[model samples]
Target: MTLMTFVYLIAGLILLVAGAEVLVRGAAKLAAQFGIPPLIIGLTVVAFGTSAPETAVSVQAALDGKGDLAIGNVVGSNIANVLFILGLTALIAPLIVSRQLIRLDVPIMIGASLLTMGLAWDGSLSKLDGAVLFGGILTYTAFLIVSSRKDKAAAEDDEFTKELGLDETPKPYGWVINAALVLGGLVLLVAGSNFLVEGAVNLARALGLSELVIGLTVVAIGTSLPELATSVMAAIRGERDIAVGNIVGSNIFNLLCVLGLASLVSPLPIQIAANALAFDFPVMIAVAVACLPIFFSGFRINRWEGLLFVVYYVAYTVYLVLFSTGKPVAEVFAAAMLGYVLPLTAVTLVVVAGRAWHKHGFTGDELKR
Candidate 1:
């Protein structure tokens, strides 16, 4: 890669972070002004705002005929949101699970993950599939708005309230300034995505790496920085719900909104490397499914769980690098993860779930998750 490419990549990442922050602040302020519930705003507006980078990158890649990269970004981002972002945030502070997440949002997330797997199994997500996924987001957002209004009369939750970004000591800004922030953020996101994708694709070609690999490793992580920042800050501030919710919400949006829009731009054919099909895509689904057990275990993600998450993510990334480079150790890494780590994790989750069941004694959480 050229020095200029590195500069472009760094600049793109900086723009993504700054743009997401500005967009979120402006959108959250607008939501608060209109008296929207914190949970709804966090789940819908802030969630989509933070996910804007992924949306831009994926759609841009798709338009540029790099559908594999676009699809990889969606899948990889979802996995990272769960195992990397949420895990790290929980380590910062044990994320307090809202019963609502267990009862409602997580199930939706799992369903979405499963749907993605099914749709992509045919080696593509067509425009019809995109339409269906995009439609689901619209319906889900509407449902959230209607239900959340009834639940939270005036933005009650402390965590989501803080996500509103505008303090109680509100100094009113004119509508034009807020709108300008939103528009400028969008422009930056688009420009940043163009630069990032260009740098990544060029670097991939120069290094003899496939577009899918670049998308999964570099582009995916780069776009996910917003989620990382939001969740880390939320955890630090004890905005526990938003910390967890941001990740979950972003995962949903990555699949439904980001991929949906990208696929509509072009048929996002899953013409990817075999490793992605065999390992990464399935791993993404597995991670999504894993959330149900972990969250329900004690209705919280503990430090140990977070540590395991980080370890698994590290192992995944390392395996990808080794496998892509045709290293001898790649087989061993895959075996260890598939033969030992996965089985042990499953057994442990069963134990924890059973223990939780006995302790909590079969509330509706089981039925819901």
Candidate 2:
């Protein structure tokens, strides 16, 4: 409500972005120096680093017994990552979906989304549930590393390595510098999270909104800025792989790492609000499911599809705002989306998927072009 509140929000966002950038750069360089493959670094370290803000914020909220904020941040972030970040990125330049994403990563993302929902079905995420989610991420990462080794070996020229300056010979004390960067980044992230959470909690109180709603909207979007920047820049630079892969990878981490770690660290189970279980979870699952058909259609997200995605995200956010404010229009808007828009989208996606599959059998890579 006050200027200081806005200052906290802005300052927190700036620090989170700066911290993530430093952490990812340092970690990527360090991984490369240690002979880790560029692809693995991109999939694991960079993705995790970009999601560090969510991890920090959620864990802090959970420790403070703000369970809704913790849960909302993770679920909302995954939604925003796909609907908002990817949507905006694709609009900037049509994103080419790699076969690997459609065939493997997207499915994993969907599975993860479902698994999270099932775990939260009981209304809270226990430490055991957290462990299960955390274990899944470990298994998934190991699988990716092992399976991608051949591809990594065959990569005579890795653009990611070159982009990270990993192609250069290591200098003396390089690891030391990288380590400092990682540490400094962590410090900034911790400090920024405290500020952001405090600001968000205060803002929620001032606006007569729940912390969950603030987490779902403001905190979620603020923390996702790194992914937004990364994907949009990758799109412009023609590194379509990074642009698409980054979003998918980050969603996975947000679920498996951010939420898992938060729940594990909390003194009590992180409770899932009834509203979240009834609405947000379903919406997140639908968004994840939607990715498959969109990616399958020509193995690319066209500009119009991007526009559709952006429009849907706006509609979704507006609905949440209206619903939270107890506006009468919320019901009418929800009715329209349910009765008309959603079914139309479902039919459109099915048609597109069918045509693409018929054009080039599912096994064929012709759509990659």
Candidate 3:
């Protein structure tokens, strides 16, 4: 590839990061000014702002008729958000799983993912399918907002207070300044996504790789950098709720908002690649379902669990590279993972979840801290 190609990728990444940072900061402040709970802000405003790059890039790719790139971007991003970003954040500090996430948001996320799979079963996403997905996001957001009102006790949590600076005095004209920042961030995201998509398509052609592979591996990770940064920083600051919530929220947003909008804007239905339907979609769904047992195990992600996540992410990425390059070892690796690692992990998680349930004597209404 030419030097200019690499330049585009690097420049695009820098802009995406800068844009997401600005957008999240402004949006969080704006939400706080309205007296929104910090967890709600993390799940909605911060999540949507950090996800702007995926929205921009996927929509741009759809308009260009590169449907695979668009689809791969959303799927890959969801995968990375959980496996890479959340894993890394937990490694930094074991994350506390908010009960709201387990009882509400995580289940919503799983449902959204299953809905995407069902919609894509026809191999194309029509405008009607887009409507269904987009509608889900609106409903989910409204539910979170309404439900948050009953959970004012969450506002008293140390992490929420520290994260949102709930006691700090608001500056005059804060809303106006925050609005400007949001707009400026949007402009940068649009520009950056354009560059990133163009560079990715060209690089795919040069390397004899499919646009889908490039989108899944390189572009997916690149676009998800914002979520990575937000989660890692939150974890470092001990804002455990925001750290975990951001990843889960962004995954839901990616599927519902990014993919739905892209499908709607496409002149024709976006095609779902056969491999993606058979493999990637199932993998994404498995990852989402896996969260239940892990999070239920004492309502926190331990460092050991975090390391497991990181290892799985690494193995997943390596498999993608090998498979894309037609390496014989790819099959062996897949077989090993399916035959041994996955089953072992599943059994281990079941035991952990059961032990936690028994130890806490959890009823339908209560979970011990």
Index of the highest-lDDT prediction: 2
Q: Tens-digit lDDT track for model 2 on 280-342?
A: 999999999999889888888998999999999999999998999899999999999999999
Worst 10 residues of 2 by lDDT: 150-159
**Which of 2 and 3 is the better model by lDDT?**
2
**Per-candidate local distance difference test:** 0.81, 0.89, 0.86
What's model 3's lDDT at 117? 99
Best by TM-score: 2
Candidate 3, residues 1-369: lDDT per residue as tens digits? 898889989888888888877887777777788877677776576658778889988999999999999998999999888888888899899999877788878998999999999999999999999999999888888887776656654654445556556457788998998889888888888888889998998899888888988898799999998888888988988787788888998999999999999989999999999989988999899999999999989889888888898899899988887888899999999999999999999999999998887876455333533
Off by over 4 Å in 1: 28-43, 157-162, 165-173, 267-274, 362-369
True-vs-predicted CA distance for residue 250, candidate 3, Å: 1.1
* Residue 136's lDDT in candidate 3: 88
Query: Tens-digit lDDT track for model 1 on 40-106?
Result: 7676777688888899889888888887688778888888888888889989999877777877898
Point out the worst 10-residue segment of candidate 3 by lDDT: 360-369
Whole-model alpha-carbon lDDT for candidate 1: 0.81
Candidates sorted on TM-score, descending: 2, 1, 3
TM-score of 3: 0.90
